[model samples]
Target chain A: MTENSDTLGATEKEIMYATHHAMVKSGYAELSISRISDELDKAKSTIYHYYDSKDALLLDFLRFSIDRFESTVNTTIGAHPKGDLDHIILTLLPCQLKKEKRQLHCVLVNIMPHALDQEAFREQFTEIDNRLKTIIEKTVRRGVRTNVFRDVDPAQAAEHILAVIKGAMCTRLTTNREAATARARTSLFSYIDSHLMA
Target chain B: MTENSDTLGATEKEIMYATHHAMVKSGYAELSISRISDELDKAKSTIYHYYDSKDALLLDFLRFSIDRFESTVNTTIGAHPKGDLDHIILTLLPCQLKKEKRQLHCVLVNIMPHALDQEAFREQFTEIDNRLKTIIEKTVRRGVRTNVFRDVDPAQAAEHILAVIKGAMCTRLTTNREAATARARTSLFSYIDSHLMA
Candidate 1:
């Protein structure tokens, strides 16, 4: 057993990234310290030196990954200053890396069951979810005020947008049908173009 | 340790219903044959007599529940001749049993992680999900044909509607906030009323 630390330094960040990559490769069910070490090319003992158990490492890893992911979204949102709403919506989408990889959002969803058991993860997830929705709410409100969008409640519009993304992602995750997923995604934007626009 | 039966009879349906009630009460994690037996006021042997184990019974119960639930939705759809689109959309909404009880849909979602392991459950769930979505697709197409809806692609529009419903249900499941859930649900209908209408 080792002492659990609250914050991650440079080395800790590397370890968390290793854990995430390992989780992405195999999934959270088979995630282990040994595997994380293998991914990072670190000895198992050295990896265990910073964390007491798999659970502790995973909890911290979830927090770290979520923080990093949120910051990236914030950066994307910030980059598009008064840009097209479609591009902003596109920025929030989960993407496939290649024939091999997917975005971290998909990986997080794969371990959703595990997160349900962690009180801290649930609280953090709720907050992160709300913040993400808030960004959309602001965007929608801005669109409405600028006469780009119809008179719609920003919060409800935000909720619907999130739902569309979630539902589309779930469809893709389950079916792995690119065409069907694309249709779902495209339909959302078209709905926005037709309905949400003033 | 025992033979797995292929079909369930009336008694078996009753037993499955008991298992569902028990699941709704204690959730999937705490669900057991003994708990189901207690719920039904039957001996454990009685349950074991029909099914080999909890997993087998649950698989069957999921199939049974899906069948029954689809029938109810189909019944609701059939009851509406020249039905309003809002009524059609309302037919697909998830329900709460009472102030204290939620419908079994939430229970199914609670066990979603477990379903990933079972190929039967995954297949059945996917098929059932597609069928439910198909109902919405047909409704949207009918609306478009009758000039009640905009000329939207039926499949894509269906996907968006299902996504909204799924996203809203997921929110309700996670937040348990009545106001937020209602807002999410209402937004979808309003979106249709405003955008889908010709």
Candidate 2:
């Protein structure tokens, strides 16, 4: 195996991937180590060896999810025109409509309640949220400078945007994902256009 | 005991009450019949007599929480004039700021992830959410007719309002409850005012 591959062995990676799949399928509350081990054809001890406890396993999976989300957003933005704020928002949101992304969001929101209960998890989740908020804030500020967005407070606008995205995620998880995504994009674009400075 | 009192004996009430307390203190995931029985100094069978299973017990608690939320919102609105939409929105939000209301929200949001996994729970939760959305939509429409709100689509506005409330709840659960609650209320009211006809 390559050096990088040896650092994160196939078994460990498989375990993390399996856990993520299980969480997305059944939710965090219903996930069990035994089920994961059964799927991986590994003993429970092996899973425990990789992760001290179920919480540890979950925390690792959440961290991985956040990292993947950040990368995906960044890559999508990087591949497009840098200063197209509307395009950036439009592109990033539709990604949520994808099967994998939707599942990831399900797992994220599902774990949120428990995450709030754990100090470490709460801090980590908040950190990720703040980072995302900062990105949106910066984007909105850029839009304002270019007269693409109105002179509203960037922080507040960012919060509103985030709220819409989160709400859309919840609605999508419960109902038709395609319809919810379409509505969210339409509503969001309308809000942006209406609020933008001519 | 009176006939009405005899129907729900002291022990049954004690078990239910204890279960509620346990959910508030430790969350729904930590709740179990044995734990409730232990807390109430009753036998497991005695607790089972009141609830068929842990799922049923939790479902009852969830229903109770939803009812309390609905009643609180209604009561808050009723305390003011019928057409005073501003007062209604402002009054209803602060009720969520209270400790008890926040706890109930915690439980509600927490169970959403598992809703898909549990058919009965999902149906109950969906009904509650739909009812809440309807109430908001009706209030917004009334505000529009009375010139208290702008000519914006009532359904969209209602959904946005619900989104803000859910976002605020998540923020409160993840961070400082008081601060999140205050900020959420202020932002929501401001958005409403900004959109209303001058």
Candidate 3:
């Protein structure tokens, strides 16, 4: 489990790209090698040559997405722990996502149910959840240590904040309601201002 | 639109029952009329007489689910506003769900992605989200009025609480992580105790 997209081969990169588009267009349940190859404008044999099945390809795509997400966080944020936390909250809100990223979010949301039945999918999703939780946990710990945030339980606070992020994202995605996310963002930042900031 | 399960006729009730079992077993994506009929142990024509297609059947099932959920909340809770709030939170937590109810939750999670592509599904899901939010909002308002809860923005508080409920459910369902929900439940109850209670 490497978090380096740079390590992927050229063909692997292409497959990931095609898989993204295919998932965005047809969703996870409808996604197939043929649909991915159609998106790639290449032979299905090309995808089959590298990956044995759709689930394998999807797992790779999930890893690729995680790598991209990590790189984005590392490069775009981290100026300050609080800023990083706020930026992550905004980024996770589905309303703030751009078209392509939103499609990616949609597909990830789509794949969540499959995780119920597929152990491989469940493991990868578990990793995804833990990785995100860990990131938030680290930031909270750093903030508390630096005295920028009030003395608080970093793990518990991180869980609460991540809950708001996940809840806002799910509300927006599942309901397609803009007001829900708006309210959640307001409530979360208010908590950070009142309870978290020193 | 009506939240009365009693309005359903005998065959409609039977169909809803069969649909519930079918969805619980096969899931929404794999669900078909044949599967539903198989669950009913009846001819395909019998189901077709009630539902024109799978989507129609699913739409009714969604309404049926909402009705059942509403009845459960109304009957099981409502002794007092604060107690109702706590009970709703406990009810929405997937970890607290029984086996059959957990299967129903899984199917609802499965339907969320399909709602993205299908407008009717999207509308029904929006209703589900709003209905839940509204229930919490009303409870919060009542609690505040009765002086059981601290003076707070009822709508905002409701949204935040609902976010925690949803976030906890999604975390449990997607990652199959017990620790996450346990932490979430602790964080949420702590928040309610410190922030909301009078």
- Top candidate (lDDT): 3
- lDDT per residue for candidate 3 within B1-198, as digits (tens), equals 435457778998999999888877777667888888898899999999988887687778888898787666555546588788878877787456677787887878877887877777887778877888888889889989999999989899989988988888887877867788888888888887777889
Chain A TM per prediction: 0.79, 0.75, 0.88
lDDT of model 3 at position A64: 86
- Could you give me the TM-score of model 3 versus the true structure? 0.91
Q: Residue-wise lDDT of candidate 1 within B1-198, one digit each (tens)? A: 112223678779779878878877787667888999999888999999998987778777767776666666666544322364466556555444352234465555555554444566566557656766777788788878878788878888777887777666655555323465567667887777776777
Q: Judging by lDDT, tell me the better candidate of 1 and 3.
A: 3
Each model's lDDT: 0.66, 0.64, 0.81
Q: Which candidate leads in TM-score?
A: 3
Per-residue lDDT for A37-152 in model 3, tens only?
Answer: 99999999999999997778877888889877765655544658889888778777744567777787787887787787787788777777777888888888899999999898
Error (Å) of candidate 1 at residue B180 is 3.5
Candidate with the greatest DockQ versus the true structure: 3
Rank candidates, DockQ, best first.
Answer: 3, 1, 2
Clashes of each: 0, 0, 0
Native contact fraction per model? 0.39, 0.25, 0.80
TM-score of each: 0.79, 0.79, 0.91
lDDT tens digits, residue span A127-193, model 1 = 5567668777887888888787888788888888787876665555543235655676687777777
What's the DockQ for every one of the candidates? 0.39, 0.33, 0.73
